[model samples]
Target: MLRLIMLATAGLLLGGCLQEEPAFPNVDLHGRLVVDQEVTGARQAQGIQGEYYKRVLSVNGQDMAFNDFVRHYCPDSNTRNETCIKAFRIKKIDDVSGATRFLPNGL
Candidate 1:
């Protein structure tokens, strides 16, 4: 019985680790979409090399990471599609620095 309990506990812990992160709600988010370039030396050393582009949502000056946006608005789909774009109510696109910024409607 003790062995079974230990096995069950371990299984639960592993299951939790394998689960996907919680997604944000699909509410109207007012923000600017910006591209954040992420480079990891560790990943490159492991033979995975490339510039990873993360879509950051800057709302009221606060930045939300790509995972949250993709999980909420475009799960299992590309983040640059019309659905994701329309959700933010894009106003203007500007090339600032190395990031592509999309201004939200209104401001």
Candidate 2:
């Protein structure tokens, strides 16, 4: 008798798990359009690689695509690679010697 009860309980549990869930009303009836985007050459260079993100910014009460004030270069202290490095690392040139305080390459 106990074995029969266990089998019945297990059957009920498995049966409940197998049922499909009902979708919400009007979900598919209303939403229909789908858009797929593919990244291009310039966007590929800027988006996953470029240091900063492009966004709609307010400049002088006008909206424009302006590059942020940033410098991208590989620091000498780190292993040089294709990855663009973002740093506040300032390049100061000696007024007298006319030589940079450090190696600064910004692109």
- Provide the overall lDDT of each model, using Cα atoms, as 2-decimal numbers: 0.49, 0.32
Model 1 lDDT, residue 7, Cα = 100
Please count the clashing residue pairs in each candidate, in the order shown. Answer: 0, 0
The list of candidate 1 runs beyond 4 A from truth reads 1-39, 72-82, 85-107
| Candidate 1: tens digits of C-alpha lDDT, residues 1-107 | 99999999999999888845345444444443442434445446679755334346653355676446545555544345564555433322321222234444543
Which candidate number would show the highest lDDT if scored against the true structure?
1
lDDT for each residue of candidate 2 in 1-107, tens digit (9 for 90 to 100) = 99999999999999988834222121111111121123234555665542222222243454432122112122233433322122222212222222122434551
- Residue range with the least summed lDDT across 10 consecutive positions in model 2: 27-36
lDDT of 2 at 88: 24
lDDT of 1: 0.49
The CA lDDT at 22 in model 1 is 41
